[model samples]
Target: MLTAYLTHPDCERHQMGADHPECPERLAALRDHLLVKGLLDCMQEHEAPAASDEQLQRVHDRAWLLQLADQVPAEGYARLDADTLINPYTLRAARRAAGAAVRAVDLVLGGQAPNAFCAVRPPGHHAQRAQGAGFCFFNNAAVGVAHALAAHGLLRVALVDFDVHHGDGSEDIFAGDERVLLCSSYQQDLYPFRDSHPPAANVVLAPLAARSGGAAMREAVTQYWLPALARFAPELIVVSAGFDAHREDDMGNLGWSEADYRWLTEQVLAQAQASAGGRIVSCLEGGYALSALARSAAAHLRVLVEA
Candidate 1:
């Protein structure tokens, strides 16, 4: 089966202020790059739907979500935090971004696709169960994991985050949840800083030093993530695929390149093939530098389709 590519126009509407790096151009760049590289032609495409309140509740507290919805601005921007802002369409866009992951999960698990990539934005790794940060309003990957567990009765789901910054929100939501194993490699001393020690047994937080390059990331995945993932033998695999670590991206100092993204996808594909019927639902989490994000995402999608 062909891989699925999911995105939405609403994602472009959830923009922060003009100077922010997580701008709408990120999505536009990815779309343009995939088209230019002929990557879009190899996959089935779908526009993301708005997530139901029920699905949002699986990963967010209902009251917190209600408060966020109530705070959305009609004409201007409302600041959720120092870095996160909500425009009139922000909440709807966040729901749609989260829904993209949920739908990708449904599609992959149902055998409609071998794997899927969500190209939506307002990146989700920094959004916690009850808090939003780092331009993230909803925990999209967490929402997808919850859907796989609740809807498909998945026993064990593995979440692998390769963002430059730690996936603190995902750690918060899945902490102590025995059914899920969370493995990640992030730049040390970065945003949402405290993930060196996860509060749960299933979390393997590998923080690499700045300028460590892709070799360090690859080593951590091979030595730590792979073993933990193999032991868990998950029924489904979820990826918080962030390309901010690229060398061209000033978002972080990991110095990764497009080849690194492709290599990482290959590793994840191996784990999925071994235990999960090659099922993977990757949600875009972070990537700011327009050109690098586009190239890295294209490399990742190429592997997701070819593998």
Candidate 2:
């Protein structure tokens, strides 16, 4: 089966502002690089559908969903928090972004695709169960995990997050759910600082200090993430893939490179191959610097698309 590349044009319409880091151009940059690298040719492309309210409710509060729908402005931008903003198209974009993750899970689990990658916007990882923050209107990765567990009757799912910022939203949504194992790594004392403690026994966190290079990340993944993932023996693997840790990206202080992303993808692919029938659904999260984001994402996709 081919690797699936999922996205939606609506994702490009959810622009926060001119100077905002999480701009629509991020997706364009990634696609341009993947095209230039000939990576798109090897993959199957799919347009993401809008996630249903039922799927969204699996990971987010129903009240919060209503609040977001009511807050969508007819013309200008509405602020969700200090960093998150929504324009007229934000709701549709957020739905598509989240839908890409759900569709990715469906494709991988149904055997239509060996694996899948979602290249959408409004990076999720910080939004909590009842709140929208950190440029995320919906918790996309969490939505996918919930879909796998509740919709597909998956008993065990592993979520691996390598964003420079912690996946606090995922932690919040899956806090008491023992069916999901979350193995995450992030820069210490970064944005959305909620890594005080593991909210559940299934959550494993590795916080790296500022300026720590790829060596530290490798050690963390090998020691913490891999071990936890092996013990869980998940039926599906979900990746909260973020590229902002690249050295060229100033979004964070971590010193990662495109090669680091390649290595990380390889590791996740290995685990999936061993335990999950090579099923992985990766969703785009944080990655601000356009060039670095494109290069790192391409490196990661190359591994996913390789035969």
Candidate 3:
């Protein structure tokens, strides 16, 4: 009946370092803002459960999963890559963050919730099927999409990402998968620095220039994403909601604002209503500046809770 809000306290314990941009405080700031805005009042909140190994393996290689598990440290941190590190609680927190998305999918598809928002951290989207990178251990949105198709018997699903950086991991995992449509928008010349190779038809890339601002993003969505999404007629919609592109965040130079995030979410919701039975599972991805992250995330949630 209401939007399902899923999170776990353990999500905050997985830290890269005191100075890492993907710190635990990102979640805390957004959560506090949501509470203060009373957005949580309109939603049904639930603590996220750990995703089963089977569920995670559907979207990730079992060997890679085992490797990540083995890398968890007992005292300090283990480096997964230049941009990713795992502390003692990292694996558990990553599992819970990913599990939140899976549970959100379950709740929405089972008629328990009209839609859902996963507020967990250690944001996922950059973690590919075989390797974890970009401050991510598991691809949460991909895991959710896999579950919707494999476990829930859904054939058509869509994932929408609006992070400042390309979701190369999501693209890697879902490329050539006709059953799912992946529409992503990111600033050009950003992190992960993917090549300009031809993407599969299922994966639509809308790369904006630095400081292009929200106008370019909205135009890309209108010209590219809407057409593809309409044709797919998806049964569910999963969102990789990121806010680092905001003008104040300074993570990338897309030069967006809270209003842009609000508008983007509104478009996603409209598409969901068109063919997905209003089913949505939105997960937190990238947002750095504490004040901006809090404000932008709160803006996104206002649309979800109200819709």
Q: Report backbone clashes per prediction.
A: 0, 0, 0
lDDT of candidate 2 over 37-124, digit per residue (tens): 8999999999999999999998899999999999999999999988888899999999999999999999999989999999998777
Candidate 2 deviant stretches above 4 angstroms: none
The TM-score of candidate 1 is 0.98
After superposition, candidate 1 runs with Cα above 4 Å error: none
Colliding residue pairs in candidate 3: none
lDDT of 1 at 179: 91
**Where does model 3 exceed 4 Å of error?**
none
lDDT of each candidate versus the true structure: 0.92, 0.91, 0.91
Error of 2 at 145 (Å): 0.9
Worst 10 residues of 1 by lDDT: 191-200
Tens-digit lDDT track for model 1 on 1-307?
A: 8999999999998888888998999999999999998989999999999889999889899887988989998888998888888899899899999999999999999999999999998789888888888889899999999999999999999999999999999998998999999998899998877849868899998899999999998998899999999999999999999999999999899999999999989989999999999999999988889999999999999988898
Pick out the ten consecutive residues of candidate 3 with the lowest summed lDDT.
Answer: 195-204
Candidate 3 lDDT by residue in tens digits, 140-167: 9999999999989999999999999899
- Indicate the TM-score of model 2: 0.98
TM-scores, each model vs. reference: 0.98, 0.98, 0.98
